[model samples]
Target chain A: MANGSTLLVGIAQGIQRPSALQRMLPSATRRVLNVQLTELEHHGLVSKTIFAELPPRVEYELTDLGRSLLPVIEVMEQWGNTHRTALEQALAGNLAELPN
Target chain B: MANGSTLLVGIAQGIQRPSALQRMLPSATRRVLNVQLTELEHHGLVSKTIFAELPPRVEYELTDLGRSLLPVIEVMEQWGNTHRTALEQALAGNLAELPN
Candidate 1:
């Protein structure tokens, strides 16, 4: 999955805390993930809450708009999975082996 | 919309020919569009047809799988449109002026 989609799915699936998200998407650089989260927050798709406690708790939750996009994302994911075989072959980038 | 989405929408909307696609998405480099089209075809989302004419003609049509994606694309587009205001503000990147 694309980084953005993965991040959104991670958040939607309850990896709202920053550290948890980092752990969930270990492949994604922390800086890149933070930027994507900020973009998501700025676009009003996700809401960020910061606690004033000593530890400074922070969490992210999908806004109504973000929730609404879940269906679309799900459909896209399904499509990707359904075509995974052909997509992988395509990504392999050796079309000479395609149907002769 | 992202380049991939735009290209898919263009093909879905009958801008099937390469030159026409170029015209429809003028900002997209011809090479990049070709690459995207090839990827779409590779993934089985689109089928290419080449007519054996004196000058040769090529066109693309969404496959059944691709057609199924229309709803997702439509929903995403609708979401983008609905959140255009906030999204534009987000893109502008000046959060200090946000609601106080």
Candidate 2:
């Protein structure tokens, strides 16, 4: 359920429909996606478009501000990939001490 | 508040402490980070380590499964950066029809 906005962005990249998003993510995650989308839309990071039709077709896409975040996201992803092993080790070391 | 896991990862990459995360993000987002960290630890995506001390100290890091996700996160970030303009245009188009 965490990083719902990124998931929404993932959905926008391809998922397209809310129903599809629900199916792709878990139930709790679906709720997170819904909330994130609302916030993203409110922030103008994303926008919803409805085309005229009997059912009223709708789609979500990123906005200018959102686009501006692309570089940052990309850097993060790159960093994640490059440092995966070290990060995992760090996490594992931390987990070893957690109480059951 | 959305994408809290990613934010947490960002924190782990450097933030190191909950307080640092709080200062880096908005208030609502700080709460989300706390929640996401808990879930991440529960799922073994992250682990916490406590050092022995009078006051004690803790740190969070990624796990093996979480490391596996690094490739995915990287791809998403690259995609975001590469497709920034197109995504923005798409989002802009969607926003055009939103009711006030």
Q: TM-score for all predictions?
A: 0.77, 0.49
Q: Write down the worst ten-residue block by lDDT for model 2 chain B.
A: B1-10
Q: Write the per-residue lDDT of candidate 2 for residues A1-100, one digit (tens) a residue.
A: 2364455557557776766666666654666767777767755666678889988877778767666665666666666677677767666766786887
Residue-by-residue lDDT tens digits, candidate 1, B1-100: 3777777888988989999988877888999889888878876678899999979999999977678778778877887787787677655654765676
Interface root-mean-square deviation, candidate 2: 8.2
The TM-score that candidate 1 achieves is: 0.77
- Clashes by residue pair, model 2: A3-B3, A61-B91, A91-B61, A94-B48
lDDT of 2 at B29: 67
- Estimate the TM-score for candidate 2: 0.49
lDDT of 2: 0.65
Task: Write the residue-wise lDDT of candidate 1 on A29-94 in tens digits.
Answer: 889789888878876678899999999999999978678778778877887787677667655654
lDDT (Cα, 0-100) at A64 in candidate 2: 70
Q: After superposition, how far is residue A38 of candidate 2 from its true place, in Å?
A: 12
- Chain A TM-scores, per candidate, are 0.86, 0.74
| Clashing residue pairs for model 1 | none
